[model samples]
Target: MTPDDERFDAKTTVLIETVGHHVQEEETDWFPKVRDALGRKELQEIGARMRDVRATAPHRPEHPGSLRAADALLG
Candidate 1:
C-alpha cells in the first residue's frame, strides 16, 4: 500500500482507541451519576432514545483528525 494509505489506517486505529477510552470513562464516571440522578423509568426512556439514535445513524469512515493522530502516533 501507499504511504498515504498506511497513514490513514494508522489514524483510524488511534481514533478507535480514543473512542474506547472515552466509552470506559463514560461508564465509570458519567453513568453512575446519571443513574443516581435519573429515575428508572426516565433512564429506560433515555435508553430507548439512545437505541433509536444508534439505529438511525448513518455509517461513515473515521474522521480525518483521528487519521492524522494515528499517523503521527505510528510514525
Candidate 2:
C-alpha cells in the first residue's frame, strides 16, 4: 500500500506501538530472567556468535522495498 494510505498508516502506527511495548517488557522483565537462566558465560558465547553472524549479514536490503519492510519489522 502507498505511504499516504490511511489504512496503511494506521496499521504501521499500531505495529510500531506494539513492538515498542514488547521491547519494553522484554527489556524490563524477560531479559533479566533469560540472562539468569542462560548465565553470563553462555550469553557471552551467544553474543560472540551473533557478532560473527552480523558481520556477514547484508548491510543493505536486497530489493526496492525491503529496507522499509525490514525497518518496520526490525526497529
Candidate 3:
C-alpha cells in the first residue's frame, strides 16, 4: 500500500476507537449517573428545553451536491 493509504487507515482506526471508547463510557458511567440524579419531572423539563432550542436554532443551507454524496455513502 502507498504511504497515503496507510496513513488514512491508521487515522480511521484511531477515530473509530476513540468514538467507541466515548460511547462505552457514556452508556456505562455517564448515563447511569444522569438517570439517577434527575427525577422524571426534571428529565421532562430538560427534554422540553432541548426541543425548544432545536426548534429555534438557525438553519444553514447545505451544498447542492452534499445530499447526493451523503446518499452514495449511506445507501
Per-model TM-score, in order, reads 0.57, 0.67, 0.59
TM-score of 3: 0.59
Q: State the lDDT of candidate 3 residue by residue for 24-74, as single tens digits.
A: 999999989999999989889877765765554445437576565445434
Cα RMSD for candidates in order: 10.6, 6.7, 10.2
lDDT of each: 0.74, 0.78, 0.74
Model 3 accuracy (lDDT, Cα): 0.74
User: For all candidates, what are the clash counts?
Assistant: 2, 0, 0
Query: Which parts of model 2 have CA positions greater than 4 angstroms off?
Result: 58-75
Candidate 3 residue runs with Cα over 4 Å from true position:
1-6, 56-75
Give per-residue CA lDDT, model 2, range 1-75, as digits (tens): 888887998999999999999999999999999988997898898778667656555567775666655454345
Ranking by TM-score: 2, 3, 1
Arranged by lDDT with the best first, the candidates are 2, 3, 1
Clash list (residue pairs), candidate 2: none
Please give the range of 10 consecutive residues that has the lowest summed lDDT in model 3: 52-61
* Greater-TM-score candidate between 2 and 3: 2
Best by TM-score: 2
Compute the lDDT of residue 4 as modeled in candidate 2.
83
Query: How much is the lDDT of residue 8 in candidate 1?
Result: 84
Task: Put down candidate 1 lDDT per residue, 9-41, tens digits, no spaces.
Answer: 888888899999999999999999999999999
